[model samples]
Target: MDPHRLLIFREVARTESIAAAARRLGWTQPAVSQHLRRLERQAGLPLVVRHSRGIRLTEAGATLLRHADAIATRLHAAEDDMAALADLAAGTVRLAAFPSACATLVPTAMTNLARHRPGLEIRMTQCEPPAATTLVTSGEADLAVLFSHDSRLPDHGPDLQLIPLTDDPVRLVVPTGHPAATAAAPLTCLASTPWIAGCPSCATHLAHTCEAAGFSPDVQHSTDDYVVVQNLVARGLGVALLPQLALDAYHHPDVRALPLATTERALYLLCHREALQIPAVAETVRALQQAATAHRPQTPPAT
Candidate 1:
């Protein structure tokens, strides 16, 4: 089968409209239609049916789409592998990382990559784990630096390879004069305290941790930015549970960061199994590992 024709068919199957597929592929509608006709001839089956609303795939088209998807994946893998073999000296390494990782680990890693692999271009996008995972899986990103609460990573296929880099402990931020400011206790100590959650995911984690400790947190505020969360706590707005990475990146002086020994998010450098073979991917992984080592919280900061 012609890979180009298969690609056009896949796009049409995805959009369910030849014109929409042509627009997405930057090809004229006639060109896309021609390719689909040729593909149907090769397969000796009616692949699509036109109706007033749009096109619907025949059973043959659906079956062929599955094969086309696999073929595209393999072809992309081949390109990655060939790039790996061709040059360690120059290539773009697309990276997706969460905001906190972007503020800390990613910058350090990029610095090291700059010093060590000067010819490599590092393109970064700040994304939460869910979006980052999709980008890596779809080959939009070469790799992603992501974090999960214990083993609570999002569901994905075996194609994703997770490499453990570090564990960022969750910490409690209290106003400077709050009781917990100078004391270390299980998160239950703040059970009755009003809370500020970093993100919806962090809020869920906080609620779960508190529930596990016998109560639910009263999350009075929410924001995805840790710096904002810390600022709110510093001003005595409310206490919060935050990851050590965010604290490392930016902590307000008026807030005391107390260790929550029982809670932590594990950081992983994630890549597609095929991407691991790319030399730039391997190089960036090493750089990220070095940064993680330096930033990994070895001990709880003094209260």
Candidate 2:
């Protein structure tokens, strides 16, 4: 089968729609359909079935897709190898990171790397942990910055390496002048309070933390944006638990942050183990580590 046809078929299989694949590839629908037809003919079987919803891959298509994924991975590795040959002086370092990290750490690191290696190019995309991991493992991104509360989050693959960046504490956010703002407020103290939670994972973590404190939070709002969560708290709609990095990035003056004694999220940097040999990747890792260290909040001296 033609490599080009195989890639086109793979895209179609991924999106489950010829039009969507064409849109992604910047081609017309007819072009994508034609390519799929050619690929199916070469394989000597029907690859997809059309329905009102979209398309579903046939058994043959599924079988071919498996090989296509492997080929794509190999091709991506080849591209990375060739780029590595260019050394640190030139080539792109693609990065995928969650919003909080992007807002806090990425800019400083990018600026530092740019000054150190003017010829190096950096590209970044904001993504959640799972998507960022996928981008790194699929070779779409050279590195990924992610966070998790669980200490034992699984690695993407055997060849992938994860570096712990920092443990960012979770802080309780309350409207300015609220009773909890000036005093030490434990998780149990906020049990009956209406709360604005972060994303699903963050909400789960918050719930677990509250449960461990012997109470369940009355979650009144749910959103992925930290700023929005803070605003909600500021408006006296609810309270929230926000990551330290996010608070550092954008602190709402209308709200106050109180440190939580029992909750924190672990930040991490992910990349292929072999990619470290490349000068650009090594330099980027260094820059990221420096940024992470600089951004980490210092603990107050014990009284």
Clashes of each: 0, 0
TM-score of 1: 0.70
Clashing pairs in 1: none
lDDT of 1: 0.85
Per-residue lDDT tens digits for candidate 2, residues 1-303, read: 999889999999999998899999999999999988888889999999989877999999999999999999999988886775466766788999999999989999999878977778889999899899999899899999988884657358888999888788888888888777555545666778898887777988888888887988998788999999988988989998888888888988898888767578898899999888888888888999999999988881111
Point out where model 1 deviates above 4 Å: 1-87, 183-186
Q: Give TM-scores for every candidate, taking all chains together and pairing residue i with residue i.
A: 0.70, 0.69
| Cand. 2 Cα-lDDT | 0.86
Candidate 1 lDDT tens digits, 133-153: 899888899999888885686
Lowest-lDDT window of 10 residues in candidate 1? Answer: 180-189
| Model 2 lDDT, residue 171, Cα | 82
